[model samples]
Target: MVKLLAILIALCLGQAIVAERIVNCYWGTWANYRSGNGKFDVSNIDPWLCTHLSYSFFGIKDNGEIQSLDTWLDYDLGFINQAVGLKQQNSNLKVLAVVGGWNEGSTKYSSMAGDWNKRQNFINSALNLLRNNGFDGLDLDWEYPNQRGGNWDDRANFVTLLREIKEAFAPYGYELGIAVGAGQALASTSYEISNIAQHVSFINVMTYDFAMASDGKTGFNAPQWAVEDAINYWLSQGAPANKLVLGVGMYGRSFQLTDASQNWPGAPCRGVGAAGAYSGDGGYLGYNEICLNNWYTVFDNDNAAPYAYSGDQWVSFDNVLSVQWKMDFALNKNLAGAMVWSLETDDYRGHCGEAYPLLKAINMKLRWT
Candidate 1:
């Protein structure tokens, strides 16, 4: 057991960096419903794998109040209770409840933020959710402010919503954070970065999904250069390097090649690839499924990212090395830390060999300085 003890010591030493950095890991509760080994819940999570655990995603009501999207999974099954209870095991763990997600849409968020009484209603409900659920804070994930069929005033109103939330959260020592669109095209239209950054503790920039299945072309889901560029753009827009948390997608974007031999990036795609046995979802593959396969993998020279293909199926994702590279990039730039799109998507099962390999890789990169 001496060998194992020594190995554990080495791993523990690397985790020292997270104390000053933010390794925010989102736990999408939907994973509990995934089939077979695909299922992941509070019991399966390693508390030590993250500095901050965001329980996604609480929904927004039409009247601008906080709502639980899955009442049974959150309340009836005790996921929220069990999630916050983890702080008992890890004193440093900060569990934040995220409100709003891509599926929640911008219509209600726009209506809420754009109205005065609704903003207060939202704030009061947010406080109630935190205090009632024992969540340390709230993560407002409005998706986008002015886009997605939202109002024109949403750009400024989003900041107003954050300003109020920040004020309300202060007296109670509750932290406020946001997950924003990262690309220039999206961020420019979606946020007032400088102002929004002033109110929240951490700016979780959603850097992944730069290329999706709908693009109709093969591309990296979250390329290293793309991530770097997003970081640079946020910095240029006055987002503090120390408060920025790089968002990493723990899954890959996949597509079916229009032509068998045309498998390079930008290759025409006929449609999304077949669903994975474990992921049970089309157009995306969890690292657990991808790492175990022997698909031919290629590294993009310009972006320094990797992609794998089997016949007509093509996917772009990060391996351990690519993840570490981003971590190194984050540290080198003095970023607060990196946040994964989810904890469930990582190879948490050790189906290949090591459990939570992506999480471990990111854990190694969690340095504040």
Candidate 2:
């Protein structure tokens, strides 16, 4: 019993240090992690990676199975509430539920906008979920707010949603956050970022997927230059530096070239993804898949980006070194924090593996300077 008590005390102290460290939870749900154990094993997983376990809550279908965002809320409340209880019993792990995503789009948000009653219902539902489920906060991954299929009417409505959510969550002491795209086009089309900045705790910029063309000749998906530009634009547009959390990709993009004659400069191959296959959807492949297929080799410099090439296939993806560069950028600029995509894809065991090491380095650095 004495030994057990000592171990518990050590764990409590560790958790306190972890909670104050940087926040790095993956979207925690997608094609890869839609429905699984709902609990990630943080034992081998880096505490930095699993420090904040964010489960996605997006299922917008009809036919009334309590799906969509509504049912997703119940799902998180049920599983995560229990998880939080476990967190208290065992200690460590501050979990959150993310709403909406890139594929599901932001239609529900559009529908809930303008109407005060419906808006209240949405906000109340979110707060209730956090209260019942044991979530530390809420992340609004609305995919997009303006642009393309997004309704212009929902522009101001998006702000309203943030305002309502902030107000509702404030009383209950829940954190409010949003995932934004990382392009000027997004800034132009999405909700009023400047207006919404001060309200939410911080903004997670989706700073990857630059152009998504699978052809190996394309530029970096989330180039450091591009990311810096996006952040500069946001801050120039009035986003508080300390309230911005840069987003990094734990994946890579691959492309194949047609032939020597057709190969574009820096694009090593004829096409990308599935080996010479064309994807109208997007040409990029993730880092996990890249390693799994053994299609591309990673190369990194001090610039905070990695590049790889295989045969006619050539691609550039970000790695921990590049990520550390960005972290330094965040620190120098006094930004809030940084976050990665889904945690499942990180290179867990390899000479090139860096997700955990880099995260630990960041936590260590934050502790000092």
Candidate 3:
């Protein structure tokens, strides 16, 4: 009995010695415009729940200058100030200004990265914005470097851009990160993963959106298989396991089934699902709406994901259970941590029994005491 007790104690001590993993959450500027109960502002955030908060997004201008997509909220309305001010409550929290989301497109990024002068100009612009706004770092959300309207050379030029940015950020002790695609083909072709990893502080792998309305088939929004494949591919390409952060979707992708009987995965879909109550977007529903609405929840043991069906509409999203599974997977793989797409989509109001339940699950699984 004493020997067994000693072994258990040793294991407990070993766990306690492990460093805490990062919980990076992305906050959308447009979430302030959400109507009704779903609306979210910087004040809605719980600083203690996250180690880092990435503000999305800042745009790249034609002249390779960095600009805020929403100047009024990012500057005029004092959102940036208020966001950074959260550090007072949680001293360990870090805020990063994210640049180039999907809507910003890749045309300007390609142009900026291709030319030496343009790349320097962009780096300088980004540094100025971060320093002026009191941000601790910068996150490059270039969408896809070599795909999505970008040139083939982007695969190589991306590494150069990150190297320059890292060099510039070194003296100031600023952090640099990038968001990468989650598919094997997209990740391998769009990123020189090993080279880029050497420069950036971390890589946020976008593991959601595996299935969409246009795919013509019903499936999980972010299947477990895609997550495993993406992470393994990055690791194989020499990305440090400690610098890869898994991306979790805070919303669900909805699909309109062609026939009610065809509600299972791989079934035919006619079109996108109906518009959400607060998100105001067709074919997508935030966790807030998903929790309130009544649907028969079905867990896909094979995919390690969950989907819900009500009438002819089917929505696939990550719940507390699935999020926990992902967190566990990250721990088992010795990964750096996990990040959420947008904090606004979460059930932040406690309407779903607890405030930020999904995020809470992450915190618990990551052993953040």
Best by TM-score: 3
Lowest summed-lDDT stretch of 10 residues in model 1?
Answer: 360-369
Per-residue lDDT of model 2, residues 199-232, tens digit only:
8988888888874554335567777778898989
Expressed as tens digits, the lDDT of each residue in 1-369 for candidate 1 is 999999988778766645668889998899998898899999889998888999999888888998999999999999999999999999889999998898998999999999999999999999889999899998888878888879769999998988989889999999888999999999998888899899999999988888876888888888888899999999999999988999888889889999979999999999998898777878989887788778999988677689999999999988888888888888889898889988998989888879998888887667432
TM-score of each: 0.94, 0.78, 0.95
- Scored by lDDT, the top model is 3
Q: Write the per-residue lDDT of candidate 3 for residues 1-369, one digit (tens) a residue.
A: 999999999888876744367789999879899788978998899998898999999999888889988889878999999999999999989999999999988899999999999998999998899889899999999988877789899989999999999999999999998998978888877888889999999999998998899999898898888888888888998999999999999999999999998789899999999889999899999998999888999999999999999888999999998998898889889998989988998999989799999988888877554
Candidates ranked, most accurate by TM-score first: 3, 1, 2
Quantify all predictions' global Cα lDDT against the true fold.
0.89, 0.63, 0.90
Candidate 2 worst ten-residue window by lDDT: 273-282
**Of the candidates numbered 2 and 3, which has the greater lDDT value?**
3
User: Could you tell me how far off, in angstroms, the CA of residue 328 lies in candidate 2 after the best superposition?
Assistant: 1.1
